[model samples]
Target: METFLSNLSLGFSVALGLQNLGLAFLGCLVGTLIGVLPGVGPVATIAMLLPITFSLDPTGSLIMLAGIYYGAQYGGSTTAILVNIPGEATSVVTAIDGHEMAKKGRAGAALAVAALGSFFAGSVATLVIAALGAPLTRVALMFGATEYFSLMIMGLVLAVVLAGGSVLKAVAMILVGILLSTVGTDLETGDERMTFGLIFLSDGIDFAVLAMGIFGVAEIMRNLAQPESRDVVRKPIGRLLPNREELRQSWAPVLRGTLMGSILGILPGNGAVLAPFASYAMEKKLAKDPSRFGKGAIEGVAGPESANNAGAQTSFIPLLTLGIPGNAVMALMVGAMTIQGIIPGPQVMTGNPSLFWGMIASMWVGNLMLLVINLPMVGLWVRLLKVPYRLMFPAILAFCCIGIYSINSLPTDVMLIGLFGLVGYLLIKCGFEPAPLLLGFVLGKLMEENMRRALILSRGSLSTFITEPISAGLLIVSAVLLVAAIIPNVRKGRDEMFVE
Candidate 1:
């Protein structure tokens, strides 16, 4: 208790410093702007801005970058609510009932609930990190290759559950993503597997390129094909504050979502991405009238938005505590830390206590800043939705192209975006979901690496994964989940639960 309070005191002192606070505020502002603009995610934004961090102190730079991450979560809900377009994967669940609420003339109310719920979640998650971060890091250090491999297996199975429709389709998409992940040279052997004489293929496809292509460019193409009337929301913006009954209904889901997100965010392999989806599933299950889902259910907006924000904040745990990147964004953050001459892992907490704690403290501050920025600016975002699709799409495309090209200054990357844009369009046309593919792509490389390491350590024995207790338990759960998903009666019941 003494150590916790002392560390927090040091954190507040550093985070409250004039320069760090200013940087945090600036990052929040910029992150919110990018989040409002579809296809321009925090990954691209942070990568673009990484060069600027070279000039600032390491602690301040990280504080700013961290601010951007959670701020984008807040801003993403705005676009999802007002425009029916989710700016980030985390906000995709938010778009379901959020847009429905907009159509029902409760756009302002939905946006307000999202922002407030996010603030509440962020505050609680920040505390979780502060109190449990070091101990969690200790726990993470105990994980070996076998344990990690099994954990990845579990994560992949959960990804399949995230799909709203056919589980078979989701599994196929994930397998395709794993195949795509294998395109680069074999890391251990240095032999190219799928390069096919193309040097760009040797390095594997960039996540930003793939994400921008599928989510951003593909979305643009789809919107362009739709009629203008179908794209715009014609409903009046209703009251910003929810009624007493609405608030009463939402608070429970918000609390539940915060707990769910905070716990999931600590796992490896981008577990945070699953939080909103899981929260949505839970809210749907618990609701008295499950039929209201996807049609202006305030709980849908409140729960997922809160979960999204909490997950985004806590996803930092693995990066800060163990030097492991849980997702693409954290992978970029690893690069940022490396460039700043700060080594990640347990030593960071011991060696630079202020830097570690300050970053954690800034998360709470950033969330507060987002609430201040988003509530009043809700009107501005709604007006952006009023912009015609023709104009908005061009801007989205331009920004995507710029963000992709800026990664390596290569036109090949932009071309790849175009290629994947077409692929994404076709997949959607065929009724396949893109989110599962992304999850697979993100985890595939890590799973392969861990599996190889575990096998090597066990002298090529596959049983090593099941021999370890933690690994065994996780794998067993995954097996049970797979079986349940496959069983006809269980599958039918699961399908019925999600029916809208």
Candidate 2:
């Protein structure tokens, strides 16, 4: 307890400095702007801004980058709720019920719930990191190749539950995504498997291109095809805050999601990305009226938004405590720390206690700043709904094109975005969901790499995964989920829950 209190004091002393606070605010502001812009994610934003951070002190540089990371979470939710375009993978779940709420003239309510939930989650996660960071890092380090592979298998099973329609079609989409992931060159061998002789294809498909094409461009196409009166912005804008019933429905989900996210975020290899998806699936399963999901359910919005933010904050645990980068964003942070001549890991906590704790303390302040920024901006975001579709869609197209082109300065990527847009439209027409495909695409390479490593470590013995306790447990759970998915009664229940 003394250590905790002492660390807290040190953290506040440094984080509360005027210069640090200003940097935190700037990061939050810039992060929100990046989030609001379709296809511009924090990874790109941080990479772009990294050189500027070299001029600042280590503590302030980290504080600002941390602020930008979580601030993007808040900003992404705004776009998802208002325009059905998710700026980040974490915001994809929000777009489901959130955009539905917007169509019902409840855009204000959705945005408010997202922002409030994120703030609550961020606050709790910061505390969790402060208290349990070391222990969590130890647990993450214990996960070997076998355990990691099993855990990802379980995650993919959960992704199966994320489907709102035909289970077979969802599974097929995942398989397609796995196939797409194999398009790049073999990591171990220099041979290309599916690039079809195109040099750009050798690096595999860009995630931003896929997301923008499917969600942004395809959505614009769909909206244009619809009658003008069918647009949701034409409806009266509803109240900004949730009512008594909404508050009651969302409270428990928020708490549950925060707990889930805190635990998952500490895992290596982008485990935090799975938090919101897991939260959404859990809320739907636990709901008495599961059928209300994907139709503007308050629980859907509250649970996932909270989980996303919590995961974003807690993902720093591995990096700070073990010097392990959990995702690309953390990888950039590792580079930032290295450039600042600060070595990461347990030694840094002892050697530079102020820098360590100050960054942690800044997370709370940043979350507070995000809340202050987002709530007032709710009115401004809702006003965007009033724009005409004709003008709005072209702007979206321009943004998507610019965002894609900015990634590599390649026109081929722009051409690929259009191609994927057409593909997305076809999939939508066929009643298939693109969300599962995305999950599969993201996890496929990780799963393949880990599984291969596990096999090699065990001398090609298949039983290695089963012999490891943690790996066995995860795979068992995955098997159970698979069996449950195939059972007649469970399938019927799932089908009913997803019925539109």
Give the winner by TM-score: 1
Global local distance difference test of model 1: 0.81
Against the correct fold, how does model 1 do in TM-score? 0.75
In candidate 1, what are the lDDT values of residues 1-500, reduced to their tens digit? 99888888899999999999999999998888778866567865675566566678999999998888888888888888777778777999999999999888988889889999999999999999898888966776688888877866776776665455677887898898888888888989999988898998898887667766776677677767766542446777788889998899899999999999998887654567789999999999999999999989999999999998888888888778766566657756765776687866666887898999999998888888999999888767666656666766666577777767766889999898899889988898889977667667766776798899999999999999888999999899989977776686566879999994
Give candidate 1 misplaced runs (Cα > 4 Å).
9-23, 30-69, 76-113, 230-257, 260-308, 311-358, 488-500
Deviation from native of the Cα of residue 49 in model 1, angstroms: 7.6
Error of 1 at 60 (Å): 6.5
Locate the minimum summed-lDDT window of 10 residues in model 2: 228-237
Give the root-mean-square deviation of each candidate in angstroms: 5.4, 7.7
**1-500 per-residue lDDT for model 2 (tens digits):** 88788898899899999999999999999888767655557865675565566579999999999888989999889878877778688899999999899888887788878888999999999999899764654575677778878876776675565445676787898788778878888989989989889999998876666655665666667666766531335455477788888888989999989988888887654567889999999999999999999999989999999998999999898678856556657756766786688865666676888998899999999999999998887666556534556865666577668766865789998898789888877898899976666656656776798899999999999999999999999899888876776686576888999994
Instruction: Give the C-alpha miss distance for residue 407 in model 1, angstroms.
Output: 3.7
Which residue pairs show collisions in model 2? none
